[model samples]
Target: MFYLGIDVAKAKLDCYLLTQLEPLKGKAKVVTNTTKGLADLLIWLTKNHIPHDQLHVTLEATGVYHELAATQLHDAGVCVSIANPAQIKHFGQGLAVRTKTAGVDSQVLARYCAMIKPAAWTPPPPEARILKGFLARREAILQDLLREQNRQEKAESTVTPELIHQSINDSITFLNAQLKKLQSQIDDHIDRHPGLKNDLD
Candidate 1:
């Protein structure tokens, strides 16, 4: 089995290809972390004559930066491993890897994965990801409401314009209405998933 290790960053991904018998295939390369870039990487692999089914990609989760790549790769029928950073780090130490760079990190991840052969990662369901996004939006709106209310309190009777005060109140009202709608959707989603509802209960 061939392992492809990727070190993900906000703007780019450093990739290294390896095989169990051979430590490295070629020099590591960097590609922009975008859909087009990922496509190009696939093309590069094909140009190099690497079979997709023989490849297993691995990377450390870096917040949401890794999500797009992982999802895209998985959707393309590629196996992906989202390794724990601590575990990867320990593996690096075990290999006596004293230097660190994006290329080096990718190499270490590939070597570690080749040695350990971690299980493939599955992306979350689309509905669950959407719900999570909505929840984050709701939280942001609540925070905005809190901040506006605090500002209103501080500016109370301090010669603030009536129009400005009214605008703030209107914003809060809109946010509250949105929050209610969001809560209803969330509840409906939870109800649809018996396992989630049970866990919540």
Candidate 2:
């Protein structure tokens, strides 16, 4: 299996393609960190005569920067391994890598993956990701509502001015409405996306 190593960054992805496992060396390329860039990367692979099913892409997780590429490749039927950062680092250390450059790091990643054959990682499906976003917003609104409630309670218990209590009460009411609206939106979204509903069920 051909291994492709990617060193993910916020702005670009440094890649090293390992056509053969013997030397852990091949072509190096840089692509922007975006969907368009991923598309171009696929085109590059096809131009190299590499099929999606035969490609094994590996990269160390760098915050959320790696997620987009992983998801895109996985969806395109490419095997993707999100290597453990610590493990990748140790593997690179074993190689005695001197200066850390995009090219060097990507080369190390390619070598480690070619030898270790790390387990493939799967990102959440699109429907699941949507639900996650909704859930995150819901949690944030809940936290805000709780804070407002706490403030209201304190105001009622202390010598706080009446206007302060009224303001807190208004905030609590607004938050409640927002929570209800958000929940409705979430429900509607799930209904629109059967996969999400099925997952929840």
Candidate 3:
């Protein structure tokens, strides 16, 4: 099987197409990180004479940056694996990859895929993805609330201005409202998805 290693970033993807592992033969190409770009990547594979079934695409789990590529590639019948950041780091280290450029990262990932053949990734259900997004936003709101609370406490200890206190209180109030709304949404979502609730429970 051929391996395609992609170093995903916010704006673009650095792809390394591995033809062989021994002696390490690969060709690098970059594409925009968008729906059109993913389609273009498919055409690139065709031009390179690589079929989808024979292709094993591996990419790092770079927050939501890698999601589109992973989901699209999986849907396009290409074998896709999402490697954890830690796994990629350690694996690159094992291969003695010193340079930290995007190109080098793609090459290392290509090598890792060819050698290790990690497990394939199944895209999460839509409900799960939605819930994850909600939870992530909730966490951010909670962090904002905590920071505001901390600031208020610190300001109280100091001879801070009344306006600063008001500002802090306002932020805390907004964050609390957001958190409450998000929690309610989460609960409503759980009620809507019995299977998800069962799995979580």
Candidate 4:
């Protein structure tokens, strides 16, 4: 059996492949948060002769960065496990591995998987996924609006340009509209999904 561990980030994935009687092998691969990246990963795995069913894959739950990949892998019939980063860090402390890099992190994950053999986590249902997407988009828009507001305030005493104020107002208005739409969609989605509605209640 092959143990695959991944250190996931927003822009790239550090992958480690561990097998018995061999030195640890790892590679840092760039992957976008999109279907193309998911397809590429599947292709790479196939080329390497890694059986999706036989491979035990583990990655840290570094927020939503790991969600898409985990969902894709699980849907493809691979055994996938997500570990809490804090737990993984504590485990690494036991091994006295202090330094942190993508490669080292990947190796640590591989070793952790080998030791703990965590059970796979099933992805949330489709409605929950949609709700999560809406929430994330709304949060992103709010963040952008906040950044623009900060910029506008910083330039208040320096420039006092009418155009800058207009731009800031326009951005805020746009973000508000987007947030409203997302909220409505999320509410409707949660209402329709009894599981999520129950969880919220």
* Order of quality (lDDT): 3, 2, 1, 4
Highest TM-score model number: 1
Tens digits of per-residue lDDT for model 4, 1-201: 667778898877777776642454544444565678878877777787888888778999987789888898889988899999998899889988999997788788888887799998899888878877787788898898899878778778576788988888888788888888888888888877768877666
RMSD of 1: 2.4
TM-score of each model, paired residue for residue: 0.85, 0.75, 0.78, 0.74
Candidate 2 clashes between residue pairs 3 or more apart in a chain or in different chains: none
Higher-ranked by lDDT: 2 or 3? 3
Give the poorly placed runs of model 3, Cα more than 4 Å off: 9-12, 20-24, 32-39, 46-53, 62-65, 84-101
State the C-alpha lDDT per candidate: 0.84, 0.90, 0.93, 0.80
RMSD of each: 2.4, 3.9, 3.1, 3.8
138, model 4: CA deviation in Å? 3.2
The CA root-mean-square deviation of candidate 3, after full C-alpha superposition on the true structure, stands at 3.1
- Kindly state the number of residue pairs that clash in model 2: 0
Between candidates 1 and 3, the one scoring higher on lDDT is 3
**lDDT tens readout by residue for model 1, 1-201:** 677899999999999877443534655778999999899888888887777877889999999899988999888878899999999999999888899899999998888777888899998777667767777888998898899888788668588888988988888888889889989988888777656655445
Could you tell me how far off, in angstroms, the CA of residue 33 lies in candidate 1 after the best superposition? 2.2
Candidate 1 weakest ten by summed lDDT: 19-28
Q: Which is better, 2 or 3, measured by TM-score?
A: 3
